[model samples]
Target: MILPITIYGHPVLRKVAKDIDKDYPELEKFKEDMWQTMYFSDGVGLAAPQVGKSIRMFVIDCSNFADEEPELEGFKKMFVNAKITERTGEEWSMSEGCLSIPGLNEDITRPEHIKIEYYDENWEFHEDEYSGFAARVIQHEYDHLEGILFTDHCAPIKKRLLKGKLTAISKGNFKAKYRFTLAK
Candidate 1:
């Protein structure tokens, strides 16, 4: 579906999301749509707020580009209504960029390992312990479900520098001339 992504400063992006209730008949379909949207937009993760939904949901698939041989199929992963069940003591810093905050990247510190519980595409419960970059991605996407953006963790000087630009971006004062696309 490649739904429009809400940019920085959008009120919905700041609004705390409600948990997904069990009765939503279209939840399965929404998951599929989110996957399609992420693939078409070439994003590693996409949250409900980015797609104009205020529900606590997001999709992630980090299985691309592992093989240069091209003989194997890539893997895909999805996390629905995910919550960090447990986190370890060790922490690491990584540079993260968001689909919503285009052209902005920053280093953020997070737990190096995490245990998460969430439902998969089929709405079945699953739990797994992840470490390294996988853990970092999970923490990043999980924040989106809570109405938290990467900028919220930005350093004070960085925040001050980005303030005006972010405000303009949120107001749509800057027009993106071309959508980012994968090169062949």
Candidate 2:
């Protein structure tokens, strides 16, 4: 099932998600649905909060970036209860966008490398290091778990300039192709 993504201004997007154990209901199915939702929404990554779930989880597929970074080829993953143990290297600015915020991209500065500990869909724990585009994607998705949006990284002036557009997105005034359920 392609879950409707929670848009900006939705309370769920502002709440820190809770971690889940293996006993969580239909864990495997939920992960599959997240993948379906992400692909259908044309997103490289999707977090639980984006789908209205307050859970510590996210999915990513960076295969489309293969041509530019062969290391990302077939880089599909499910991160559950993930935590970044280390972030090293110099900071770099890169453009980032979110499915929930739709139709906007901003240059956000983030570290060049990271080491994270997370559980796979099958519940196997793994600690891995990533860099370049891979690290950026993971960092973006990880922010969602912490109730942080990509827009939060915008410069003060940039944020003020985007205020109107952000408001419009919150009120469902934007013509977003993906259906976003407004907060009640």
Candidate 3:
């Protein structure tokens, strides 16, 4: 199933997500649904909170951008209970968008590299490092779990400029090709 994404202003997006253990009901099913939802929305990544689930989980698939970001070719992954131990290296700005805040895109600055510890869909633990686009993607999704949005990282002036658009999104004044649940 491709679950409906929660639109901006939904309280769930603001609350910090909780970590889930192996007993999380239907974990595998949710992961599959997350992939379907992500592909349907034409998103490279999707976080649990974006799908109205306040859990520490996210999925990333960069296959569509193989030509532009070869490093991310065939990079499809699932991160459960992920923790970013370190975000090092110089900061770089990259254009980013979110399924929650549709029709909004902005360049956000984040560290070039990160060291993360996370469990896979099977509950297998792993610790690794990432850089370039991979690191940026993970950082973006990680923010969702931390109750932070890319728009929150925008420059003061840019944030002010996006006020109208963001407000419109919050009030269900936006349109996205994919299904979504607007806050009531």
Worst 10 residues of 2 by lDDT: 173-182
lDDT tens readout by residue for model 1, 1-184: 4567777776677777777766776887788888887877778788888777888788777676345323213546777778888999688787898877776678888888899998876779999897766777778888888889988887899889989877766666554432422111
- How many backbone clashes does every candidate have? 0, 0, 0
lDDT (Cα atoms) of all candidates against the true structure: 0.75, 0.93, 0.93
Name model 1 segments beyond 4 Å from true.
65-75, 173-184
Per-residue CA lDDT of model 3 for 1-184, tens digit only, reads 9999999899999989999998899988998999999999999999999999999999998767679878888899999999999999999998899999998899999999999999998889999999988999999999999999999999899999999999999888878899898777
Best candidate according to TM-score: 2
The alpha-carbon lDDT assigned to residue 169 of candidate 3 equals 95
Off-target runs (Cα >4 Å) in candidate 3 are none
RMSD, each candidate, Å? 5.2, 0.9, 1.1
- For model 2, the stretches where C-alpha displacement exceeds 4 angstroms are none
**What TM value does model 3 have?**
0.96
